[model samples]
Target: MELEVYTYQFLRRRSRISSSRRRKSRSISPRRLKSRSPTPKRHKRRKSRDSMSLVSESSSASGGPKENKDDSEILKIEEENKKRRQQEAELKLIEEETAKRVEAAMRKKVDESLNAENIKLEIQKRLEEGRKKLLVEVDAQLEREKEAALIES
Candidate 1:
């Protein structure tokens, strides 16, 4: 009985130690893990900015013209890219202005067509009214002539 109790207590203590270790590991932040890790690629990327000046200095020490040529080429390329961007922006603006002008012209044409249709309808209405007035006047004249002829006879 004594041996069995001691064995159970030992097992419980071992489990408790393992659980505490797991809690500690879970509580550790990512920053601590990154600091512990060896990331050579990240270090290389950070060193490249310093390396560019070293390369230029080495080229100058060697008395080479390549460095100046490379710099001029890079500047030329950057200028060309800037010019292309400006041209593209100008073209986009022109296209937008043209689209606006076309839209305005279309709207004006539609308005003019509508106005013309309205004028035509108004003219037709006036002609119809004039025809009715003319028929009434002719009927009154015929009636007056008939009464005059009857009185004379």
Candidate 2:
């Protein structure tokens, strides 16, 4: 009887120790959970700022004559920019045309110079060839005359 009573008390003490450990692991307070939620709070603040900026922009667009005037001014500036671009294009075309004329004139002068040089070289070669042919013909005629004189004498 005494041993059974001691075993029962020991089992109860073991169960109490385990239950205390479980309680310690699972004990979370609502205040601690709320403190952990501030990260999401900060994200909500950022979202609110974005939404407020959108609302303000929408409200301002829904207001009076300032928006119309601003759009017209923007359109006018675009027209002026288009005109300037057209003028620049025209200037570029004129410059290109002038450059083409200058290049053509330069090419003509170079061609004339090359033609003159080629003509001079051809005339010199022809004159040399004619002189050589004349010498050869004269030599042949002299040999023929000598042979004829010898035959006659």
Candidate 3:
């Protein structure tokens, strides 16, 4: 009887599902799909220094090159720039090393001062304890002398 009931329930669920109720995934638009797709190669326009000049050098007021930079002058400028960069790098490295050494020395000094302070505190504690013991002994000695004097009287 239980098997019949289980089979009937399974068949009821199968019957409730219909083919017309099926759904399909959404489709992509052409423009968005094109943007996501791979692109083909195309020719590109290039701009040069001469083409970017405001005034034509060939018809200039001085009738000379718009830029006065020669090959040797450009080379000299590049060499000077390289030397400046190297000097700057060396100076920065020296500063960093000096700063590190100074920081380490400061830390060492601080640690040494802290250790000296701790030692001073320990000595002070020991001195206080010694004074307390000495006072106790002196009190006991005075009481013994008073008892002896009374007996002699």
**Against the unseen true structure, what C-alpha lDDT does each candidate score?**
0.75, 0.75, 0.67
Model 1 residue 102 lDDT score:
100
CA shift of 9, model 3, Å = 99
Candidate 2 per-residue lDDT over residues 1-153, each given as its tens digit:
765565565446545886436322232432243333546876899889798777667656745457657777888999999999999999999999999999999999888876897877987999999999999999999999999999999
lDDT of residue 16 for candidate 2: 82
Q: Residue 106 in model 1: shift from native, Å?
A: 0.1
| lDDT accuracy of residue 57 in candidate 2 | 78
Model 1, span 23-126: residue lDDT tens: 22332333353334546875787688578667757677644467578777888999999999999999999999999999999999988886897877997999
Query: How big is the positional error of residue 79 in model 3, measured in Å on the Cα after superposition?
Result: 0.5
- Model 2 misplaced regions, further than 4 Å: 1-63, 117-153
TM-score against native, each model:
0.37, 0.36, 0.34
TM-score, ranked from best to worst: 1, 2, 3
Question: Model 1 Cα displacement at 110 (Å)?
Answer: 0.3
**lDDT of candidate 3 at residue 51, scale 0 to 100:** 61
lDDT of 3 by residue, 54-104 (tens): 445543544435344454467799999999999999999999999999999
